[model samples]
Target: MNWQDQYQRWKNDQDLEPQLKEALHNMNENEIEAAFSGTLEFGTGGMRGVLGPGTNRMNVYTVRKAAKGLALYLEEQGMADRGVAVAYDSRYQSREFAVETAKVLGVHGIKTYVFTGVRPTPTLSFAVRHLEAGAGVMITASHNPPEYNGYKVYNEQGAQLPPAQADQMIEQVNTVADELAIAVKDQSEIEAEGLINWIDEAVDEAYLRELKSITYRDDVKRDLSIVFTSLHGTAHNLATRSLAQAGFDHVFAVSEQVEEDPEFSTVKSPNPEEHQAFEYAIAKGQDVDADVLVATDPDADRLGVAAKKADGEYHVLTGNQLGALMLDYKLANMDDVPRNSVMINTIVTSQLGKAVADHYNVTTEHTLTGFKFIAEKIEEYNQSGAHEFVFGYEESYGYLVEDFARDKDAIQSTLLACEMAAYYREQGMTLFDALEQFFERHGYYFEDLHSLKLEGTDGPEQINAIMEDFRFNPVEGAIAVEDYLTGKRTYLESGESVDLNLPASNVVKFWLDDDTWCCLRPSGTEPKMKFYFAVKGETREAADERLKQLKDRVLERL
Candidate 1:
């Protein structure tokens, strides 16, 4: 249906959710247009959007629609009886949305194990595999703003739904004619009937147990001071417990941001990748003269770190730098890594860590964009028995040290980063210092990201136009270009087109001369366009200048 018909369909529903109706009543013309112009789509990961009352918004109606689609998909696969594991974070309405999801599945006679309280997305991934469930659902927007929420689907293997599975689920979700009128079984009734059950401690215990495998240097002094903040999301208790279990007991929690504050009042945005998210943690670190400050996003699946330099001011490490530090630390320390091990990162992520992996004789692989592609590769490797997964990371503050949970896990990264800090601090150094040394050892590899937000009706069109112009129109000095959207790579010198051999996406990349590269793509989660720049140089200053030159060259044309 068109916007008018979609809006009218919600208005005419007798059992409309009151919150949704009120949101619609208060919306202005532009808000209405944005809300009804199109439905929030579920991609390889899942659907995410602002909370409101429309086809384009996230609400109970949309959550139920997604759950029904997932139920249908499971039934078609003959796996509905194996049930689904449901978990949520501390976002607004996240728990409620999770309860709604469970109810929808319950009404369809599909069993569910719902978390009584909010948990991290990684825990949910572990729960799915621990319970041997058919699937999993996590109600979170993963570092999105306070107004936003999301629905993520996971396979039984405890990874995000692969592209093929997500495609099938999307087709089923869009089949719904009217979501506002959809009804679900009562939560109390479902629990009494045993269709919905709360997940037990066994799953959490199992996940925490697996975390120990990532902890390498427990023999190091646990007295090193570290400040960890959850940014008012779901990482407080989990991080504390994991750190304590990993033998780092000197952690200081940022008191203000440790609680479940749905508004995320302390920071402008809860995203760990942003520097402002560490405001409270930095203050706390300063108070205690801590060695390192760590943070996790709302869902606790992405981690960020800031360490004190010689001047005593904290320097936040970019994802690339930290990934390199962790990669080198991991390879240099692990005594019994599997032979023929592999490491994976996305196409847009920096290659500094790749150099570290290469030094250790581990093969490096690149995925399209999301961690699901990496997870899919892990599954293939495990099945074929040709390679063992070592580590996977992305420039967007996502990392996976172990394949136990198949998704980017902040818990594991947090543990290892803390241990890394302690390991260096014992030698009178810090993580920032370790990062500089890493660059010295592995050559200076720098990566930067610039994002442009395009919201409302014209935003998507503008983004599409940008990609199209860049794809067809040639850049002046690019030696080669890879358009993942078309799944083709154009070798300019040879004028030969080769298949990209990766999943198709709305992304274009240009390979310049001398290890310099840039990638343009629309963000899968938000209404923004991201430009990723990667370059290598003899010095940090040279890399920054080269990056700026390339950035100015491309952005001026845009």
Candidate 2:
């Protein structure tokens, strides 16, 4: 049947959920088309879409279908008995979705472990490894708006399902033609059947125990005042406790943003990457004259910051700057890093991190975007023992300090950020001051990211057209252009091409002649295109000016 028939069938079904029925009643034809055009496509990070009552939306039926697919995939891999750990954040119906997932997996005779309350996405990764589960599912949309939710899959090793494995799982997901027909066992019966486990304090304690590896400095004076906000997600208790345990006594939580509000009452958007998310935290910091401010997304996987400068002025640190600062701290404070210690980052992240790693004699490796890739690298290194994974970061405020959690962990970064801030404070330096020193040492790396949102039916097509144009005619003065989708890097000067030696992805990056570069990629989870740019110069102003020129050159073509 067509989408209209599907919609009518849903509306005609006697057992249609009341909330979903009301939603269906309110939607117009265009809205229904938006919700029924197609299934929410699952890619590298699984599927994410607006929540509503349609096959294309993130609803119970869709969740059940995804869970059934994952269960089948696990059974095919012979890991079904090992089970899957499930978790959710503070989004609307997140708990219900998690329960539905467990119920579907249980109906397939697969054991499931689910958190009792809201948990961060990273914990799902950790719980999978910690419990020796076959896979994991996290119900979140990262930093997307409240209307959005997502389903993310993780492998047994506690990383997001790599593309190869996800392809197979998606094939299984697609085979289930009718999502509404799949029957799930009752949640209450699953527990009685010994197939469902409710986990909470135990996993939290174990995760916290492993977090000790990230406490870089123990003797730093906690003289620096620190402010942290969870952005109405899941970081409040974890971050504050982690700080207290690390001896950072002076800490304050941005009370307004700490509570779990699905609406994200305090901010327009619950994204930590945006400076606006820190509105409450910044206000509290200014009132208290705090030395630093930290904010984490709702799911507590991404972190953002605003550090107080010398003159009591606060400056928001970009993700690139924060990642570089942490990398500098890791390398600088170490007596001697492990032999062949390696730091990981994405292609679009700032090169400043690589410079710091080089200064400390650590190898730097680049991967396609996403924490899962870095997690896979860590798991690979653990198996091969070729190199020690020291730190992993991205330009989107995702950072991982320990391999315990095979994902970007904001709670871990929150405590470490405080520790780093306090240590620098002992030297009479703020994070902003340390950032300047990094510029002085690493030649002032300037970077910026701009996203163009083209929603509705034509969005994806428009994005594809833009990318096609880039492939044929790139920006001027490109020293080299690396197309990850084709695994080719073309050297414009020599007319030579070589395989990029990375997984195929829809990302095109151009490196310029004067140590400047820009990359273009459509966001996998959101309806948008992102442009990332970086430049280096002897002076900060020169770097900013060069960055603007480089961005303008690329923006004109797009």
Best by TM-score: 2
TM-score of each: 0.97, 0.98
> In candidate 1, how many Å is residue 463 off?
1.1
Tell me the number of clashing residue pairs for each predicted model: 0, 0
Report the alpha-carbon TM-score of model 1 versus the true structure.
Answer: 0.97
Model 2, span 1-558: residue lDDT tens: 678988998899888789999999999999998788878876678989899999889999888889989988998899999999999999988999999998999888898899999998878888999999999999998788899999999999899987789899998898888788888899889989988999999998898888777776667786678898988898787778777777778788888877899999999888878888888888999898898898989888899988887677777899988998998887777767998899999999999999999988899999999888888888889889999999999999999987888889998888778889888888878888888888898798899998999998899999999998997788888889999989999998898999989999999999897668999999888889999999999997898899899989989876
Instruction: Flag regions of model 1 displaced more than 4 Å.
Output: none
lDDT of 2: 0.88
Candidate 2 lDDT at 189 equals: 95
RMSD of 1: 1.4
C-alpha local distance difference test of each model = 0.88, 0.88
Candidate 1, residue 252: the lDDT equals 93
